[model samples]
Target: MPTPSEPVDEFDATSSTAADPVLPAGYSMRLLDWADLPAVHALENRLFPLDAWPLSFFEEELAQAVPEPDGGTRDYRVITGPVPGSASGTTATGTAVTGTAVTGTAVIDADRDAGAGEAADVVLGYCGLMCVPPLADVQTIAVAPEAEGHGLGTAMLLWMVAEAARRRATDLLLEVRADNPRAQRLYERHGFEHIHTRAGYYPGDASAQGAGGGRVDALIMRRRLVG
Candidate 1:
């Protein structure tokens, strides 16, 4: 187990995600629908240019909501609304989410407002999880730049842990950038053990955004649950 006291990574915390109860005022979270793909995809490129997932990745995941691996299932969620009382109702670093950016919706969700526009449904963050019984993979979790420093990260992680447990996942797995010390701290707080360091795992030019393959390490973390 990597101790919390261990030195954190030397690089800046790049990725982000957050929770509801711990979120700032005016924040909310719900299952992500096809409508949110455009917004989230844009954010993904911006937030993780090097490792950005292709639009098809989300499409494929959304295609099958119930991925029965002869074991568990899958889950994807997003946080809506902006930070209260702030300009644009989001954190200072928050970027506006507009429907004009991406195209297509995988599933028609009646509960979501089709005409809500970006303001009414400003997205602050999102997360993805896969629970395959004894083995669960945390596909991804991201908090908007504006939503960082708030309790959103902790809240989102806690939610994942609980959700994985609920789906009978005895172990939760995720990979964190070697530079993201803040995220590592958060995971460590939740009893995640750093089991391995994958050399050159993050392949993208470290100096440029949206550039192709470069060398950056990744820390594989795991947590045991009572499921």
Candidate 2:
């Protein structure tokens, strides 16, 4: 099985011709609030086995996002996809979900009502960034296995580009695993150019079965935004 650790940036390499990718019909992006951290962590662990981030890290990330008027220092966004009403399965907010805890601007805690006709979203993927005035760094990006090939990853990157512009950032940067040419291609398509590489950067067990994971080089890329 292909590792879900990397984002799905391509569906058919040989026949795809669109210069810019677009999300499938019905998909949408929204600000990912603190309430969504638990769901984000679950999906992160699934997509990035060796590189899963701690729950506390996401909490910190959310706490860091300030309003643009306050010189916005961080931002997080999530992509949601529509699901058939008949599909009975787990969701961020569903009976299939167990207990939870409370987070800012959202409710979470262990075992809640059956949602009582509450409208919920199916989290397809998420992305985050950290900004320091003129520059912004791509903190993370991931897509669910079932949600790939629908342009969610591309859509997220494009959204971030606009976000950087909105925040008055001059450039955006990210690191892609050396083994992930698919992701590199996707980044290149978005105007990110190879800046350099960090040797032995990604210490993921994906290359190792269960033992202490080794490391892989990371290609650093940057995109300069036009004023």
Best by lDDT: 2
Model 2 scores worst on lDDT over the 10 consecutive residues at: 95-104
Write the residue-wise lDDT of candidate 2 on 8-47 in tens digits: 3322223311122355655667778878888788866655
Candidate 1 residue 80 C-alpha distance from true site, Å: 0.6
Note each model's CA RMSD in angstroms: 10.4, 10.4
Q: Estimate each model's TM-score.
A: 0.71, 0.71
lDDT tens digits, residue span 86-200, model 1: 4322223432211111111122121242234334556667777877678877787877665555556555666777666656678988888776666777788778999988887
lDDT value, residue 210 of candidate 1: 50
Tally clashes: model 2.
6
